[model samples]
Target: MSRTAVYNLPARWLHWAIFGLIALEFAIAWTMPDIHRDTRPVGLVAWHLGLGTFILSLMLLRLLWRGVSGVPDPHPGPAWQDRIARLTHALLYAGFIALPLLGWANASARGWTVHWAGWVPLPALAAHGAAWARPLGDVHQIVAYALLGLIALHVLAAAHHHFIVRDGVLRRMWSSSR
Candidate 1:
């Protein structure tokens, strides 16, 4: 891959950082005790909440960075394929941004305090016992599963480019250095 095709250093960094955090969040979510009306934000639940907030903050930073710096020119490809790639990227961003807010709102409804790393307090998205926010936890879970599907599609597409299409698409955002 040519150096010019690569994303800027911070974009590359944030991409991987967010990916790692998302993986960790999923693992914690899978293993943590099931959330209920009486559940307290402790242990894995606290970690999950803090990490979700952190991921949301990083994603917002990433969006700001993308806006100011913009992405490198896309790898040349068939128009339809390019469109699909763009859509996939957009959906990924949407999912990452939305998932946390849903979780946060649900947390708020449950009267759970969402602190950043167990110290700094983050604002609640909904009032305690808010009916509107009650369903968001389920929505969050459903979207999480859908986002996993999108992630799988993304990896498969990258693999196709790397192994079959023999394109440099994967390397564009793979790392800071080629």
Candidate 2:
């Protein structure tokens, strides 16, 4: 296995930060029913909606970073393997960007307020969409599940390469140092 520079510290921080928040958000949002929309306590929903806003912002900035700095080279792999890994990462990015917007859209369409980290209020995207909210909400949920699936495959593949296959892919991502 060859060495490649790990992600930049900022990218790494954002990656792991969003990763933890997303995992927590999914666990809470999926396991529990939608907080009666109106009856749910502010503290709890604040975290959910707040983290979702954070994810949205981080993903946006990450995309801009990628557009400018581009993807860091992975530890060397076969052409097909590299392509698959790249494609998978692209899918994850797309999911990261889309899921939050869908949730926001659904919320917006329903005229709900989104809080940023429990403090800031986000502008609504739509006036109201009584009928559309359910479907978009469904889309948001479905995509969240899809993101989990892709994320699992990604983590498993990273682990497999690092442990079983004795590859340096994990090292390149695990830390930014030599």
Candidate 3:
């Protein structure tokens, strides 16, 4: 079968849905009270943890879907540009996976339980008061900042393709056309 020129409907939905979830994750994290071992998680902190688990699950599903369905053909561009694009996409996927795992590890190290929608409880990777908690939290923060930068770059590149380059690269993922 011939490869399509644009992403399939499921792919598009997954892309946008994940995007929204990531935004919500950031919003929750920023607005929520600081969660420490002594403090009980209530409002936004609980939402953050639950939403984070959901995002991780969605990321896994997105990766699986991409692997099974494959992606549209690369847009016509210089080899260097294409390589950069591929690298950017790789980093974004890595960030999606790494950020959540890092948060989970941090929570585990701090003796915090992460629940899925406050119903299903996830096991902690480390014991409470683990020495690694602080360091892991630091790493998580660093990675989160870097991921935000990468996202900005990705958005600017897509806008450049759509507006300046007019190459239809952005349209492939944005529109529902084959």
Candidate 4:
């Protein structure tokens, strides 16, 4: 088998950073009380929103970097498996962008302005108490759950490549240099 080139340092860092941020977002969400419009955001809720914004920004940057740097060569595998892998990656990227927009829309519908670190208020995406708030919130939750499943599948696939297949596919993303 041929050796696979590892991702560049910036790519590796962005990938890991986004992964850590997503974990932090989940932690904040699970621990914090539900934020309501009437109540000012404090503690975990504030951290959740702030971290989410940061994640979104980083994701955008990652996408830009990906576009400029391009991906490593495709892992040699069954054609079907390669297609499946591509689809999974696309969904993950879309989720990174979609989930936050959904959350932002939900917040806007609730008449709340998202502030990053207790300052730098973000613009509202919808009117206060908009008819779409509840629906958007519900969709956001559903997508989040789906994203969690996708992440699990992603990790499982990587493990399969590393352990069972004994392919260097996993190492491509694991290392910062070729």
Candidate 5:
């Protein structure tokens, strides 16, 4: 490994942080009581909302940091593989940003006041009882499932790079140093 082969420290840090947070979000979502019109943000629902907000904030920060720090050059690979990798990464980023916003809109439609990290109040994305945004909850869940598939593809690709291709692609983010 060489310095140029891996992501910068901050990029790697943000990447793993978001990964861990999203994993936690999924776990909380699975155990949380189902959201209903009259449901109050308590217990796991509160945790889910707060964590979603935090994930959104972190994604934004990660995007900003990525813009500032850029990224390491892509490991040498087939052009098609590179294209797929790029598309997958783009969708992952979009999914991360969209999930929370969709949930926020859905929450607003349900008249829930979402807060960032359980403190800073976030503005409602939709008016209370707005029908248009209500469907977004379903969309949010669908996109989440799709994103999970994408993540699986991503991890498998990384493994392929490490074992089959014998490239440093996986190591690019897994390790901080050469």
Candidate 6:
């Protein structure tokens, strides 16, 4: 099969969709609890849950497609550069897996249904218990913070490639290169 040119269309959609969702998810995760109940935290929390479900579902599909279509070639760079890319991606994949599970667990522990949007309900991965969910939420928050930091680094590296290295790296994933 032909290797995709930079990102193929599906990859592009997945990238932006996940990027936006993750950013919004992080924002809600950090600030909701401190706000008063009369405020809008409930809606924000629900939106976060809905988006997290979307992220997790699309991620599974993306992984399947990645397995079938194969990954684009790693950008050519120094040895340390390649390792950084690999490690960053591993962390991302781990967060993708962890975030939703933690959210679901948190909801379940708090006696809320694991609802996917206002439609299609998801069953709890574990029985209801604060003992289980609170710490999972804590870990989820930590991982989300880590994801934010890594994303900043990822963006800087991409920018460095575009401006400093003057390579095709950013164009492959950012613009139409065909």
TM-score of 4: 0.91
Most accurate candidate by lDDT: 1
Residue 110, candidate 4: alpha-carbon lDDT: 76
- The TM-score, computed over Cα atoms with residue i paired to residue i, of candidate 1 is 0.95
All-Cα superposition RMSD per candidate: 2.3, 3.0, 1.4, 2.7, 2.1, 2.8
Which residue pairs show backbone clashes in model 3? none
Ranking by TM-score: 5, 1, 3, 4, 6, 2
Distance (Å) between predicted and true CA of 160, model 4?
A: 0.6
> Compared with the true structure, what per-residue lDDT tens digits does model 2 show for residues 77-160?
688888888899899998888888888877777667887765788888666656656578788878888888999999999889
Q: Ten-residue segment with the worst summed lDDT in candidate 3?
A: 34-43
Q: State residue 40's C-alpha deviation in candidate 3, in Å.
A: 2.1
lDDT against the true structure, per candidate, is 0.91, 0.76, 0.84, 0.83, 0.90, 0.75
Q: What is the Cα-based lDDT of residue 167 in candidate 4?
A: 76
Candidate 5 structure quality by residue, lDDT tens digits, 71-147: 88777878999899999999999999999999999998999999998778889999998989989999999999999
- lDDT per residue, candidate 1, 1-178, as tens digits? 3336689989999999999999999999999999888999999999999999899889999999999888887788899998999999999998999999999999999998899755689889999999999999999999999999999999999899999988777788886544
* Candidates arranged by lDDT, highest first: 1, 5, 3, 4, 2, 6
Candidate 2's C-alpha lDDT?
0.76
- Could you give candidate 4's per-residue lDDT for residues 68-87 as a string of tens digits? 87777787789999998999
Clashing pairs in 6: none
Residues 1-178, candidate 6: write the lDDT tens digits. 5566677778778888888877777787675565332333256677777778778888888777777767777777799999998898778877797778887887676666666753578987767666866577678777777778988999999899889989868787777683
Q: Which ranges in model 3 have alpha carbons more than 4 Å from their true place? A: none
Model 2: residues with Cα > 4 Å off, grouped in runs: 1-4, 31-41
lDDT (Cα) of model 1? 0.91
Worst 10-residue lDDT window for candidate 5 reads: 1-10
Q: Tens digits of per-residue lDDT for model 3 on 105-134?
A: 888776678997656899887787778665
